[model samples]
Target: MNEAPNRNRPAREVIAGDRRYVWHPFTQHGTEGEPTVIARAKAATLFDADGTEILDLVSSWWTCTHGHAHPKLNAALAKQAAEFEHVMFAGFTHAPAVDLAERLVRLLPGDLSRVFFSDDGSTSVEVALKIAYQYWINRGEPRRTLLLAFDGGYHGDTLGAMSVGRGSQMFKPFRDLMCQVLVLPYPATFEGDDAVEEREAGALSAFQALLAERGQSIAAMIIEPLLQGAGGMRVCRPSFLKRLVETAQAFGVIVIFDEVMTGFGRTGTLFALEQADVVPDLVCLSKGLTAGYMPMAVTVAREAIFEAFLGESFDRALPHGHSFTANPLACAVACASLDLFEEEKTLERIQAINLRHRELLAELQRRSDVTRPRVLGSIVAFDVKDIGAYQSDESRKLKAWYLAHGLNIRPLGSTLYLMPPYCITDEEMSRAYAGLIEGLDSLKR
Candidate 1:
């Protein structure tokens, strides 16, 4: 039986199908409101069914670096598809994959020269963890099996990724299944904070104490770098990061940076590491790798780490790989996106966004209802006066308020944030900030 085709379906019709068969992530269907059916999107603006416009202030969950449906990205995909769609990446090599890898190696900081392509952010982190763990085994130090992570850092959802991010309290149900990991204190700083130095010192001390205790046993230390994304936009100073890395490497621990959310010009630079002036032994990058056009991530390793895996026996090689590893289409689009970084002058755009965020923060400082105002590159975040942790009732109110005003902003508990696509205009940023001020004032009244 031939049913109605999907191409020209209405909003209600699409949502009806979704309710019957689709299971969304991090959502509750019984009590939650119906999901907005986004029919079309472009340049930081999303239109639902009936073409109602909504400004995407959260960059559609902090992706879409260049914006939605950028014509250059679309053209790149179409051109690649005409040649070929996908090819299994084992033993075989393609121009797109090789070229993208080469470009990433040159672009990334430090000696991260080897790239292992994966399907998404979670798997990219998983690859980095696995490589770090096995790197010790291949080098005859299996005793160094423990992983290190930062408290309040959320990496991804996979078992290994969840293990490192367990301190974020997002993976409580899977605690029994995940392997052991050492979590250090994260010194979360904000604007007009007087005790930031004390917090930084205490956190550094905690890292030192932990490293001293497990110095020889830790396989690797993975951090979210300068800005911890899923941790309520908790930002740390770059000097803190530099000192932290120096301390970890001194303990003979391999360092890994999970740049899943902060990479590709999110943090006022081409990469967040560039700001910290630090280079990790391993780094996982995704999200904006293809300007959010496709799901692709890479675990880049130092040349020395890659060399350690070379051996005659298959036992010494890294056995981990995804089925869609180095898909030709993703690689081609990623290359195109990287080119747009220069063509569109994305870093300059981000600087302008940062300047605007600073101006907004100045306005936010006058309000008693707002607290912990912080800005990093294209991201700006602040907390409401008296809301609880992640998944609080008050945060839901904040979210509904934004939605009512035709904005897409999903807050982390009390912390409302904006990570607008770089293509968003100055006027749009001002509107988003003004709406936020109005929302907070309404709550206060």
Candidate 2:
């Protein structure tokens, strides 16, 4: 079990030793061990120690929006490191943090102005949940204890996030410790799905009934905006989201959009809320927030919501603060990443990916092994026939097959999805889609 960490060690050796010490997220280590060790990464490609170029079709877990180690972001991180790495965000403020917050507020919809910082997606979600929960409590409504979330919604793994994401089924072990979050059916639709209206009506009716019953006690309702990423990339209609927002607002429920996986031009727009025309009371952002250069998360809320916590008493203030909150290095990289969105024309590239996704989705439907074909922005996904479920033997075999083909495509249950970086070339994307077709064909009879 003594694997050397140098340029000479084999990739397999490093990978094998990783099993002995490292524990991966969302993985059962008892059965799944020796995870692949990526030595280096560039735009749309990861290189193992042995130098196998693995195509990153999932954007490195849906974070690297502009691509891996983007030059601008790298430079930003280096510059910030020389100046200041991190400082306690409680009483101190930095240029990168303040500038990034201002930039983000300008880009987001409506007057969502107050930005609270954290370290990752889960904490961002936790911040939003806590803020909303306490906002009502501070306003003399401590009884508003209930939270609302969609059936397939996934926020994060923290306790507060876990409560809202109870429907995701990834928290079975800690189920007893988690709080209650009311689940409403997610009315998902894909290309050429004509029954969407009926499904939306059913969902709306369910939500209306829930609001009619427990709407007063509800603190907030957190959503994935347009596409629910971890919940099998389930996509909801924009009109349905608008109606839901209106209904929640009418009932005085704080609407929160968990844009952790959908923010920063991943959905062919700056944010998914741009397409829906609905402003949320709070928005959770992370993942691509720093364009994969650093880990940072933000919970942006409306001014009035922030005002609710503005009393001289410490009890009225939100009791959340991370040591690396508003980290200068992360903020600097995020600002650079934002620049790439303009200078590099990232939106145009994403639009091209959207076109390619549509074309590939149509071709994917022609295959006999794919089912439930769906496309949202640059993301295209379908269920493979043989892969039964997330923890099934067949699922592991399918994932291994993709790895053997030098593609890092992390599947969700039987669902095979692609969310390549915005910098992915047409040739690379074509190769990935072709690999998916081949993987599907291999699983066939």
Candidate 3:
């Protein structure tokens, strides 16, 4: 087909084409620079077409679990592709999908036994929201119309996901189109913050009062357990999550844990819910599901919720399906990625990362420019003092500084954070931290 459109085009030509045609996500193309052209990646390093090796610190947007081009994951994808690429998932069932479902059922907590495959994190959340809304209708209680979400919790970019994540400040243009959601205060905490207990108590009190006022009319209460990713890497205590779940359960409110970012060993556990010792009615999982190799997500539901959607009439069934719902390649890669968790002792790696994070954050804490240092599992974040806004000058400067130093890091507003891949070596991590220190030092200048 026309020589496959020149497989070996120059990097400049590719960048020119992108400038002409590409519309990047959450990007202001008018003001932003050219996108970095990554030609290849290995382990935790990405190589640009110009032969520059960039250390991946954000896990390529918090997706790469076992790192880029992992041998085992690559082999799994190759084996599946050799057999079959893809088939419509509506009526067709494949071994890879079934095996993934079985493994997820075993790995997930509580009664999250039913897995509904979707394309990405947003769709997984959309599926969960739809299920939650329809479950009450199937149960003959269609009055549960309101949805609740914690402030600063971001689910995804889709409409339904955006509706719950409205407070995340990315959906202002589509605010009128979004459904009304009751937003609760988030008890975000940091190291050496003595007021955390007070904040937690105040948040709980507010939630309890809200439940007392409008618990019956609520359909579901969704949150990003432990860590809120896009909302600036804000972390809460596991005890707060447990208490929140208990309060929601007491009010007969369905709880949804949007574990899209915190799942699959990122949180030093299989899932964030496990650390909290809480079981949610529905959970949205993606991002690291396929170790960032393939686009896949699953909205896992409790058996009770699944049962509500089953009936004699087709009207009662949850009507949702994507053409590539459980793509064979994605399923195979996800299964392989999950296998890596056990074989490679991924949780232990995450724990080690946490220790390093604490050490690095402690050093950063001494800097006057850094504030509110927080660590949860593999995530570590701190806010820059007196930064303007989300796309502040200081934030952009720091990002450019990191890239110039051969490190990849994207700051969320004033929040500078790192969510490195599990395969990152000690030296790589030290390099990343050194870059961070240099960037912070530049802020003083």
Candidate 4:
């Protein structure tokens, strides 16, 4: 995009166009001011139109796995585009889609063998919801209709996704329109929290109580497993997750793990499910699926769940799909991203990142201003004590301070966190943590 005038337009003109035309997500343009016009990015750094360099500590919203503009990913995308860009996946198939699905199936834990493609994370969750619901219908249990979700869990922005994620408190406007979802407590824990076990025990009791009342009527219970991304990067214990999944399954409730943000070495492993050693009936994957090179997602269903949808009539068919389902370009890049994991020992990189996070978070937590400091794989998060809502004066000040310090951090209300990509270097990590301390110091002032 550096060749033409339109491609490399001045930041002022781009900002003017954005202000006039583009309605951005999670932004109040009038007060939030001009968005940075990033011209390009590499590894863990972003280059804006004004030539300012910023470290992408949030992996560009937790998608850039290996890095931005990776060579292997670029090659895969370009090669696939020249061969076969896209084809309808309903009636036909291609190597990239099949290959990617196989790779993911092998990488994923348990008997997750069926891959249903979608455009993004939300659509992937929607697919899982429809499939999980219709699975009972096809099995002659149409009465099993109510969906379940954990408190402080977020799936996506779609209607069905929002229904399950309603407890996140970001879907107030659409509450009346969303389907009824049974909410359970999430034992959101942190480092040095001695009371987590008590909360987990209470959560288990509450979950049992809910299931006892409506277990048979519930179709599926969706959770974010170890890491809940949009719900403030809140983390829970793996032992607790394993127990939750087992309890759900014992009650015949289909469990869905929403690993859209935690998959592909984000949680110090290939998948978060590995740490829990529990398999769900359905799992939603995206964000890092194509390593931030393209928008792609898949809801991998257990063979049993998939078999329920297999019948003679189209009525039993999963009546959901995006126009670009299993887009060849995306599949190709995803396949390449998976390859990079083995070739570059990405999981090991995630381990080093995790260790670095613990070291920095320990130092950060010493400050009186920070609390509930936690680290999960490459992600580190903590709350700014005595802060208010998502759009408060404290939030604005923190955002501005981070931006001024060349750190691309978007704090979740009072919760501040980092989810840098696996390719983030030592220098970038130091700078990001330094910025974190400086921002907290400014808060003290």
Best by lDDT: 3
Q: Give each prediction's root-mean-square deviation over alpha carbons.
A: 2.8, 2.6, 2.7, 1.7
TM-score of 1: 0.97
Better of 2 and 3 by lDDT: 3
Ranking by lDDT: 3, 1, 4, 2
> Model 4, 248-289: lDDT tens per residue?
999999999998998887888888999999989899999999
lDDT of 4 at 420: 93
| Candidate 1 residue pairs that clash | none
Candidates 1 and 2: which is better by TM-score? 1
Could you estimate the TM-score for every candidate?
Answer: 0.97, 0.97, 0.97, 0.97
- Residue range 75-143, candidate 2, lDDT tens digits: 889999999788888778989999999999999878899999999999999999899999998999999
| Candidate 3 residue-wise lDDT, 331-352, digit = tens | 9999999899989999999999
lDDT of every predicted structure (CA atoms): 0.90, 0.88, 0.91, 0.89
TM-score of 2: 0.97
Clashes in predicted model 1? 0
Candidate 4 regions exceeding 4 Å error are: 1-6
Model 3 accuracy (lDDT, Cα): 0.91
- What is the per-residue lDDT of model 1 for residues 245-301, given as tens digits with 9 covering 90 to 100? 999888889999999999999999888998889889999998999888889999999
